[model samples]
Target: MTKPKRFHPFYIVVEFFNVIKYWVIPLALSLVKDELSFSWWQYGMFAILFCLFVFDIIRWRMETYTLTGKTIHVNEGVFTRKVKSIPFSKIQNCNQRTPFLYKVVGVTQLKLDTGMDGDDDTITFHVITIAEARRIQQLIQTKSDSLETKEQQEVEPSVITKEERTLHFSPTAKDLFRASFTSLSMFVVIPILLSLYSKLDELKEIVPIQWVEDQAQSFIVQQTWIMMIVLLIIMVCISFVVGIIRTFLKYGKYEVSSDKTHVYIIQGLLNESSFSIEKKRVQAIVIKQPFLKRLFRIAEVKLISAGGIDHSEAKDDINSLFPFLPRKDAEAMISTILPEYQVISTMHSLPRRSLWYKLSIPSYSWILSTAIIAGLVIWVPALQPYTWLLYGVSAFILLLSVLRKILAYGNTQYVMNGSYIQMKHGGFGTELFLTKRTKVIDVSVERGPIQKWFDLATIVTSNRGKPVLHRFRLSGVPIPLADTFFTWYRERDQEISIVNEDQKK
Candidate 1:
């Protein structure tokens, strides 16, 4: 009913920095304008920066937000003039972020998500006081609570009453250190190194290639082993530093807690964020352990929700209840957050015949490739050296692939509990997926000629999201087991329908 509020004036500085990030070339040009042949480039840079600066200032000035009893409104645009009104009941998540700089200034950012896939439907407050942020959060929670009460009253009186329960969790210093040691970000650094190596042609413009080659030759001849060791140490050190920095920014001071209806997570060192999600909306819980994480006995737990939000989008930690926790602790956390879901069950491993079933395609392909390479080497004289190298490399790769397939088959397992079903499998990085049978939208069982011989089938589970349909797959499962799984899920579906009808009365 009243007028909307604006951000703090200090936000102009924030906008200024944001705009400046895009002016790297412009800034460099300004410093050397007198030495450059094209004076126009310098002026052009200034014009671009000036335009963006003015646009950012106007955009920040025009943006305003308002909250009413039932709806929240946001008005923002430079030329198009967009307006959004989001009802409190439609909001699925409430999150807050505080960058290190913003924290120092006692300001934070608040975001409201409507469970829509695109960010266009979301509401964001760029810069607001911490007090205001907390007040707004309380307002949203109050509305959700009122709506839940009304919905409960509308349902039949015989509906079971769920008691309120709460669980709080935070990582210890020791756990954080172990997480840092197992960080997979080091692999990300490999690509950066390769990219730099690939840009040697670009570097030639500044430093002569001949000089680089000569330096390399001399270093290799004089101190090959010493330099190799030093380089290895340096790369390891750099990777560790980068990994630690990234880990801290994402998970420092992390905390999570869940109640009967909602789960809340808060984390980050440099850019802190808080995420809250309803418990009932979760479609599945996935426990992930990459090689390093598995070796360290830690796992990452994430949720698959029917809502449009994927794990890949915005603050992925929002989907993850435990980014880095001991395997047992992670399972305990999942059980606490989702009481109806349990992690422990008798797992049925895939049949021994499933190994050949899994490896059939890869094995045939490798054999065909090896034959082709052998033929080429026997006929072509020039390709002899390269051909032998290729053959050896291919053989090694085939061996590795076979090993991976065998391990994956051995690790694969599935189980059927009363209300829940779980599938666990992976090549190197493993995933354990658990979901209620009622949440599974569809089930498909596939059998090729080979699978039919082995009496094996691959069962795929479909839920309500893009690209996650086949995520919960039990590959190389025996036909009988697959049939049993299908029957159990179908019965659970019917039971859920009957319960819904009973509640309607």
Candidate 2:
């Protein structure tokens, strides 16, 4: 452990794949830049890739990582020779991601983050053996434990002692089947096929969309409605099968467990990933139940940590715990893993006056839709015959806008206990945001003109988010309740030094 160690040689393959993945768009453009013919541009890209690959090998040879008792030292760079020394305590979260290829190569990627908002806050080991990764992480934990002061531990007495892990949640075959639909995994294929189709404009001779459309029309007329229904059923069947495969690949082999101090999650059938985060480091728990998920009685639960949860891909992210868990199961899982977080079931809705004030607000969407539709009808002579469709679209847009606002008014609610505050808000989807009062970094009460007229206000609470601040807004709350919300936040312990608006009070 005292000697510097070179990264696993297999990392070159990982770097190679990353180069191809990140440079795919540029590579694709080179092939089709001037009407789909290979040119010198492709050769230039190949030369660049070759140089990068050589540099990757050189970088692997030059870089070395050493795990000392107090700190981790990484010496990198060929010409500049940059060096980094990070203390054990500075590591906020450590993650192990084993993509399918990495698993085959007997190596995994390691990421140690400081949980701060900066580029330099993270150290990554692109490839390392499993044993090495665990040893490094264990050394960090042992050192961090030795450094914690007794008085600091006493002040935060909730910290649990080390204990063996206990499994809590895992999906079954039936669960996976249900998740395939509720997870909206079937929709993943649509965007992918559409992107490929968009890029295949040059292959119109091989696969003519116009010819396909004409054939579909002819089939519908010749075979009657029964055949058309059968075609739709077949398409739906294919999507369902695809959804099942996607869900199985992502969560078929998932597990959620907890030890004394940390919650552990492992998922993926092919590309296995394992994550560990201290229970105390969990800033918030986000429970989302979209319209379809609600109908299916399922929810997606994600633990928000200061280390920055990857919101971009829930299924691909290690932060997600068996996504598409049954609603009740999700609640129980949170209680089991992080008991400090409260799952509030009941909350108060906004005052009735708020709804009227919301509806009275001018519909700018209607005006914008009308202007655009009218402009199109005037500019396009062919569309002049079907101006009625433009009006219909405008009306539909207005209806959608109005309906969402109404849903928002209905769905908005908030409830606060001594230590936790829960807010429910969103249109067309239900988002249950629950976080401890001490975890909230910022709180602001806003009053708009409409809110003033209706004696209502908006209360926004901010929390730590991945590379950004996550804010939750509860609009159309009664002014009195807004004050209560503000007061509750102000009461956060003296140790939690926060700027306040005491003078305004």
User: Can you tell me which runs of candidate 2 are displaced by over 4 Å?
Assistant: 20-50, 145-162, 199-232, 310-315, 376-393, 495-505
**Estimated TM-score for each candidate:** 0.80, 0.83
Tens digits of lDDT, candidate 1, 1-505: 7589888766777887877877774456455544555567677877887887787778778988888988988898879888888898777777687888999999998777675555455788889999998888777766677665766646753454444535478777676667777777656688987998898875565456878778988888888687889988999989888877777667777888776678888888878888777776677888999987888788999877654344465645565775778999888877777878899757988878999888875577677788888888889878987975878877887997898898899889988888788889998779998988878878889888888888888899887542244356778898789888878877976888898897576
Best model number under TM-score? 2
lDDT (C-alpha) at residue 297 in model 2: 85
Every model: Cα RMSD to truth: 5.1, 5.9
Where in model 1 is the C-alpha error above 4 Å? 7-19, 36-38, 117-121, 150-167, 184-249, 307-316, 363-390, 465-470, 491-505
Which lDDT tens digits does candidate 2 get at residues 1-505?
5989999999877788778897886667556655677678678888999999998999899999888768888997899998888887777777788889877888888888777766566788879998889887776665566554445666765663555889998889999989887777887878887998686665654445788768977877899778778988888788888989989998888999888777889888899888888777788998988888888888889888888545553336788777688899899888888888869787888878978877877789898879989999999888998998889999998898788789888899888888789999987788989999889999999988888888888899888877678888888889889888878887786525433343233
Number of the top lDDT candidate? 2
Q: How many backbone clashes does candidate 1 have?
A: 0
- lDDT for each candidate structure: 0.77, 0.81
